[model samples]
Every structure is written in C-alpha cells, then in structure tokens.
Target: METDSPTIPKRTLADLLFILFLRLVAVSCFWFGLQYWAMLVGYSLVGAGRFDLLSLPWKVASTSLAVLFPVASLGLWLTVSWGPVIWVLAAGGQVLMYGLLPDIFGPNKLIILLHLMVAAVYCIFRLLLWLEKRRHRRQVSVDLP
Candidate 1:
C-alpha cells in the first residue's frame, strides 16, 4: 500500500548534470573561501597575502570574498534556489574586483573566463530544462484529449 506522502519526481540527466556542476563549483568556492581565510589569518604561503599587511582595497576584497565564498559554497552544495543567487553575487564580486579594478586587485583573466564559461553552461542547462518541461506539458495535454 502506498503511503500518504507524495512521490518525488525523478531527476532528469540534465538535472543531474546541473547538480554535479554546482557541486563542483561549490568545492571550488570552498577552496577559495579557505584561501581568503588563510590570508586573513596570516597562514598564506606568501607573506604579501596576509590581511594585516594588505592595503585597504585588498583588505576589503579579501574579507568580503572570504565571507561570501563559503556561504555560496554551502548554498551551491545543497542545490537550493539561493545557491545560484549567492554564487552570482560571489562571482559578480570577483568580476568587479578583477575586471573593474585591475590595478587595485590584480587582473585575473583566467578567473573571469572560467566564471563566464560556467555561467553560460548554467544558462544553457536551464533553457534546456524549460524547453523539456514545456514539451512535456504539451504532450500531456494532447494525451488527455
């Protein structure tokens, strides 16, 4: 006999891939957060990376990222709605740091490129999922007639 609980819908391959991607990004976020914390706490391999020695700009960017990345990591790992939102904020922070103020925060072309690529992939997956859902709805409506 079936229980009163509603059945959970199965995740499609696209959904699985999206989740995998998010988890991978979450791992990277965790690493970045760790690095920031290390720098702030004077555990960085390079002495120059330490927070106390850093100038105002570096301190601001590092502290903000140190806080944001891990929170984004948690959200991303869970694959909740807030995950992507936080990720966007964190990534956008990096973009602004490197892209808009390269002199203050050294230019990081690689980071920018990777963020763009990941964002593009996420958008593509979302579009594909929306299309699949729309097609399924049409099919279901036709079958009902």
Candidate 2:
C-alpha cells in the first residue's frame, strides 16, 4: 500500500494562521531593529563625545534591545522556541520603560500607542486561535460515533 510520494503533515487553519503570525512578528522585529540601529547611529554621529548622548537608563535599555533584535529576528524567522522570548524581552522592555517614564521616550504619544495596539492585536489573534481549536474539537467529537 506504500506509494513513492512522501506524506505531508496535515496543517489545520490555526497552524496556517500561526505561521503567518510568526512571519509578521519576524518582520516587525526586523523593522524595529532597523529603527533602533538608525536612532543609535544618528545620535552617535550627531553628538559624538557628548556625555548626555542618551539618558543613562534609556541608553542602557536601547543598547540592550539593539543587540537582541537580530538574534530575535532570526529566531522568529525560523520559528525557534526562544525567538518569541527574545522578542518579548525587547518589546516588553520598551513598553514597560515607556509606561513608567513616558517623557524619556518622547513627547510624541505615537510610540506608546503603537506598542499598545500591537499587543492588543496579538491578544485578539491568540483568542481567535483558541476559539478555532475549540470549535474543531467539538466538531470532531460530534462526528465520532
């Protein structure tokens, strides 16, 4: 009964959506990484040797995120287990710090708002995925005997 063709694992709609979500996450990570890099380089060039280049806490946080972004991007792109962990560390740090001290980030409210929007959308996606799984399970159970 064996055929020459290899079998592919069946993927449910949730799996497909998850893969798409991961891809989008990786893309956003890369985008933010670039933004961080640009800000650092631009500031460094504009104010070389300046002691107050960035406030000490902001400097430390931004540097940490700048370093973590590439590794996270690769991890996310590959769907590695730690990829999301790294992304959360970076993004969460920014969100937490900005929430604690909005002035340090900027006068503009857009950054904080964008972060909240992304978090909200992610929560919604997770909810949808859970509902999909629950519905599928119920259908399968109903069909059996």
Candidate 3:
C-alpha cells in the first residue's frame, strides 16, 4: 500500500551525536540551575552571594535563571523541539547579563565564551545534519524507477 507521506528516516550517527550533545548540555543546565538555587538559599560557600544580600539587578537575574535553567534542562533532556528554544533564552539571558551589563552582573567572560562556543557547535551540527538529509533524499529519489 503506497502512501503519500514520506517514510520516516532512520536515526543516523549524527542524530545520535546530536542527542548526546543535547543530553550533555542538559546536565550542564541542571548544574548551573542548582548553583543559582544554592546561592539563593544560602547554601553556597560565599555568604555575600546570598539572595537576601544581592542587589536588585542580581536578584532579578538570579531568580529568573534559577527557574529557567532547570526548566531548560528538562526540555533538553527530553530532546524535544522546545528544548533548544528554552536553552537559548536561558543562555542568552546570562550572555546579556554578564556580557552587556558587566557593571551590574560582573564580568563572567568564561561563561559568555562557553555559551558562544556551544551555539557555534550547535549550528555546525545542524548544518551537517541538514546536508546529510538532503543528500540522502537525493540518493533515494535517484534509486527509484
């Protein structure tokens, strides 16, 4: 029985790698979220970083991130479409906080750099996957009568 819908493509090595990367990122997001919570709850080693003592901007930034990162982690761990969107929002928030508003958030060059690198790698992997899919489709069409 022929159907109009195209056959679902089997998962490839690239797909596996992408999923692995997503899971790794999810773990990192979880860790980052935990750290924010620790600071907010006075569990962190630095007493000065506690939420009650934090400045207004820091309070806002920390609270938002404390919520966002773990939610992002859950979505990412599931490997759903919204996962990356949430991750981007969470990461971009930090980028803006530390990269642009350094005076308020302080300079976290390492984190900003890490986010940029992860973004670049994600783009590259997506491009490669797209190209591989396109090539597979072309080959499949050529093989048909």
Candidate 4:
C-alpha cells in the first residue's frame, strides 16, 4: 500500500535506553505502592489475629509477582517485538490479582474496574506504537525506491 502521510522516525537506541530508564523508575514506584498496600493488609490481618489462618507465603508470593511485573514490562517495552506479549501478561496479571482480592478481603468492584480501564489504556498505547512502527517501515521502503 502506498500512502503519502509523513511518518515519524523510530526512536534511536539512545532514546530507547532513556525510555527504558524512565520505565524502570515508574515501575519501581509502582512496586513501592504495592508493597505499602501489602504491608497494610498484613498488619491488618495480624491485628485481627488471622495471620495464622492466612497463608503468609501466598501473600509474599503475590507481592513478589507484583514487583516482577514492572521489570518484565520495562524489558518488553524496550524490545519492539515483545511489547504486546508483555502488555498482555501485565493486563492479565492485574485482572488475576483483582480477582484474588475477595480472598484478601479487598474485593472492591471499583478497584477491579479501574484496573481494567488501565489495561485498556495500555493496550491502546501498544496499538499506537505498532501503527507507528508500521508507518515508519513503509516510509523507509518507499524512500529506498
């Protein structure tokens, strides 16, 4: 397909690196928030004397998964071909975490809805990037001839 629309250049390696750094910082902040929430939940459970009944290991594992998500997300975002897979995984994880909230006494429909909304936005961002890449490739091929 031949189109005359101007295409933006794909980011340079240096730009990608800078973006990766920023993503890491953002993800770190996210992890911190998750940890804070986990601590709050843990303390509450302890205060209620339900800590023995609740699985501490499961809670820890959940927190670890939450921390792992941002690192994976940053790596995938930095790699052009893997961005979609990472986004899907991240979104699915968010949904699964939200689903688990009932067990933790954190099942709030509003929170789950908000997570879904964020997932939708993340998907939209990926779609825009894919379109931009396609446009850039097409422009490069046209310029060759």
Candidate 5:
C-alpha cells in the first residue's frame, strides 16, 4: 500500500542546529517551570506571612502556567508541532503577567523582549535554510530533462 506520508528530506547542518536550539529551548522551559514552581512553594512554606499569590487571581493563573510550561517542555524536547504553540502561549502569558503585575512576578519587560528576540533570530535562520532548500530543488528540477 502506498503511504500517504511523504518521506522526510535528509537532515542538514542547519537542521541539526535548529534541533539543538529546540532542545536548548526545551531545557530552558523546564528550568523556567521549575523556577516558578519553586517560588510558589517557597512563598507558601517560607513567606506565608509576608507575601504570596494565594490571595490574588494571579495565584491561579500563574499556578496554571507553572504546570503548563514543563509539560510543553516535553513536547519541545521531542520537537513536536504542539511544542512551539504551547511554548509561545506560556511565554506570552508570562510576559503579560509580569508586565502587568511586576510587583508579584519579578521578570522585567526587557527580559521577555530578549527571549522573543532570541526566538526571532532562530526563526530567521530557519527561514534562510528553507528558502535555500527550495531554491536548490527548483534548480535541480530545471536541470532535469
């Protein structure tokens, strides 16, 4: 039976670097998740009398994201399609939260912008590889009799 799925093109150096970037992002996602979780736990256990999100809606919203990011990290590590979607969502949520409630969540606007810039750079590199591959394919087709 003919397969509906097309064969994947051979991996190149650029593809490998892209995969490495994804893996690095995955690891960073895991770290960020853990960092948020640790803060929640620390607030609850150590700083209970001083401050915590327990009294605010941020508690629930941030808690939800604290759970989401690491799970997304797994998909990112595997380089699945859903990974980027979830990662972007988590990152956006963090940025919005921190931007609006800087007192509670410590991340500054600059940090979030920097994170996005890094992703933008990765995307630009990936686009160049894709365009190069397409150009090569067109040249090969044109040369064939």
Candidate 6:
C-alpha cells in the first residue's frame, strides 16, 4: 500500500519573473537614491557653480527624487498595492519635468531611459499580480465542496 502526502506547488515562471523584477526595481531605486543624496550633499557644499550645467534647479530635482523614490520602493517591497501607483506617478512626473523644464533642469537622456524602464517593470508586476489573484479565485471556486 502506498500513502500519498500533500505536495506544495512549485514556483511558476511568472512568480520567478515577478520576484526578479521586484529585486531589479529595488536595486535601481537604492542606487538612484544614493546618487540623489550625493548630489544634494555635494551641491550644498561646493555651490551650484561647481556643477554649472546641473544648477540649483537640478539640485532641487535630485533632492525631491531622493526623498520620494526610497519611500515608493519601500512601499512596493512591503507588498502595498499603492506602491505601483506611487512609482508610476514619480516616473511620470520626472518625464514631464524633463520634457517641459529642460532649460532649468537640463537634459538627461539617462533619466528618460530609467523612467521608461521603471514604468515597464511596474506594469508587468501589476499584470502578474492580477493574474495570480484571478487564478486564486478560480482555485477557490473549484475547490468548494
């Protein structure tokens, strides 16, 4: 006679992908925050003239980003559903700031790229969460005895 023990479901590809994406976003946010902090401190000490291209306006922008990104990233990592929305807003704001106020903030090709990348990851993660929830509902419906 053979006895069967319950087995846990293995992690799906989607789960792995979502986890990897989350890690990537977390790391990106950490690095971006560090850069902003450094810029804020450096600008305060050396004056905007030392980095004329990235003047006072750019310093202000960096300080704002440093304050916000870490909060958004932490919220997301803690599995708060609002995290994605915050990230989206931050990214959108940055894009608009870069496009509409280039003169004051200066042009930054890298920032545009970073915003696009973060947006893509946020969308993907949200989709994955939706699918997982749907799957869970279906399982409950079917398992009802």
- Predictions in order: lDDT: 0.88, 0.73, 0.92, 0.54, 0.76, 0.68
lDDT of 3 by residue, 3-66 (tens): 4446755788999999999999999999999999999988896677798899999899999999
lDDT of 1 at 1: 58
Best model number under lDDT = 3
Collision count of model 3: 0
How many clashing pairs per prediction, in order?
Answer: 0, 0, 0, 0, 0, 0
**lDDT per residue (tens digit) for residues 22-141 in model 4:** 365346435644653455356544544233444674455455555555555565545554544554565455456567756754455774685566556555665666777777689879
TM-score of each: 0.90, 0.69, 0.91, 0.50, 0.77, 0.69
Which ten residues in a row are the worst by lDDT in model 1?
A: 1-10
Off by over 4 Å in 2: 1-9, 12-14, 41-52
Q: In model 1, where do residues sit more than 4 Å from their true spots?
A: 1-7
Worst 10 residues of 6 by lDDT: 1-10
Give candidate 5 misplaced runs (Cα > 4 Å). 1-8, 43-53, 103-107
Off by over 4 Å in 6: 1-12, 43-56
Could you tell me the lDDT of residue 48 within candidate 3? 72
**Candidate 3: where are CA atoms >4 Å away?**
1-8
What residue pairs clash in candidate 2, if any at all?
none
Clashing pairs in 3: none
Off by over 4 Å in 4: 1-29, 32-94, 97-106
Any idea what lDDT model 6 has?
0.68
Tens-digit lDDT track of model 1 for 1-145: 5554335545779889989999999999999999999988888867768888989988988999999999999999998989888888889989999999999888999999988988998899899989988887798688985
Per-residue lDDT tens digits for candidate 5, residues 1-145, read: 5544335556778878878988998898898787668767774346552226365656766587788889879988998988888888888787777777677766587858866885796688769888979986998789989
Model 3, residue 9: what's the lDDT? Answer: 54
Q: After superposition, how far is residue 132 of candidate 1 from its true place, in Å?
A: 1.1
What shift in Å separates residue 55 of candidate 4 from its native position after superposition? 5.1
The worst-scoring run of ten residues by lDDT in candidate 3 lies at 1-10
